[model samples]
Target: MSKTSTPGQIRRLTKAHKMSFAAVATIGAAALAATLVPAGTADAGTTVAAAPVAWTQAVEGVQAKTVQHLSMQSKLATDAAKLEAAVKAKAAAAAAKAKADAEAAAKAKKDREAKAAASRSTVRKPVYANNLDGWIKESLAIMKAHKIPGTYNGLYKNIMRESSGNPRAINNWDINAQNGVPSKGLLQVIKPTFLAYHVPGTPLDQYHPVANIVAAANYAADRYGSIDNVNSAY
Candidate 1:
């Protein structure tokens, strides 16, 4: 005949994980109070050294296995998180360095272009003052371009003797003046000679210092070879 199962068997089943220990233990006590088993049957093989020992050992084994599984999972999760953080940190550092390098190259290019622009933008044309000295120098520069030969001293001496550095000086008693076109300007040239020999690019006005001097010098160069050779009136 079949009999109701005892607490010993339930404990053994709970230890082996066949069923939940909480559910089996709760119903085991009630079954024990209400059911009948032979007197010797319930505690007959129920010594502490019997199935209880095996049950305790089996439960401890399951707890050890559970703890091992949880520990392994925790370690794997921690390692993965650390590896991800390290990869992100390394990538961030590389990006920062690349940005710095790009900025430095851009600044260097700008500085080079600025320096080159400064070098290329320098003005080289000569600036002249508005005076007799400046005029003489200006005329000489113009003369050199036309290959005319004359010196500063040669021109200055003739100017002082002829008109005393006056641009509006006129001779009313001279033969050239008696004809109606008076000798005028720093070198005292009449209208006919001024117009004939006035250097190109200079003004046509006779009283203009550079025009008068340049015209007189041209006339002198034609007759005497150069103004520098004509120390006296030409």
Candidate 2:
């Protein structure tokens, strides 16, 4: 006759089967619990499945990080471009100011130089010790006494060209050449001419520039056609 198992044995076997099922479920939920077959019946089994995975949270985090990085990079690029443009504009403005300043300085310098030159030309000239009026008066008296033709201008020009109006003009060697004799004074009046034509108040030695010039005027008028022609060496 079939005997019933003790309670402890039956309890132990049930406990073991529960532990095995728990272990199997932990490893893979797809594994199914096996059923005990009775007399001639076939054994049947069932399986448990694992839960589905969710991807929404992880994918959103990655996308958000990527967008933040792109935004930061875009801002940096824009700021860099703006900074470069500002620098270039500042440099151009500085260059323009420098050029303007240089041009203004140059113009001012040129104007100053021109003004100085004009002042010098207008306000400066040499002064003579002997006044021009006195020389003219003395020259006129000589011309009248000598009976020389032409205006006093001729006498003035001749005297200036000959000795620059130096009254001490002399040619002692005129004695040797006989071309001129002891011709002294401004006009270089020869000794013979001075003696013959000496004026009443004038001495024979009145070979002074004024005296000589008067005597030369009369001699030039008698010999040469005119004072102008004499000046031309005729």
lDDT of 2 by residue, 127-194 (tens): 42353345545656556555556456777777777656777776666452366455566666667776
Tell how far residue 90 is off in model 2, in angstroms. Answer: 99
Candidate 1's residue-wise lDDT over 46-158, tens digit each? 53223344677999999999999999999999999999999999999999999999999999999999999988898555887877788788778877888888999988888
Q: Cα lDDT for residue 118, model 2?
A: 89
Q: Considering every candidate listed, which one attains the maximal lDDT?
A: 1
TM-score of structure candidate 1: 0.49
Error of 2 at 233 (Å): 4.9
Model 2 misplaced regions, further than 4 Å: 1-133, 145-147, 173-180, 232-234
Cα deviation at 208, candidate 1, in Å, is 0.9
lDDT, model 2, position 45: 56
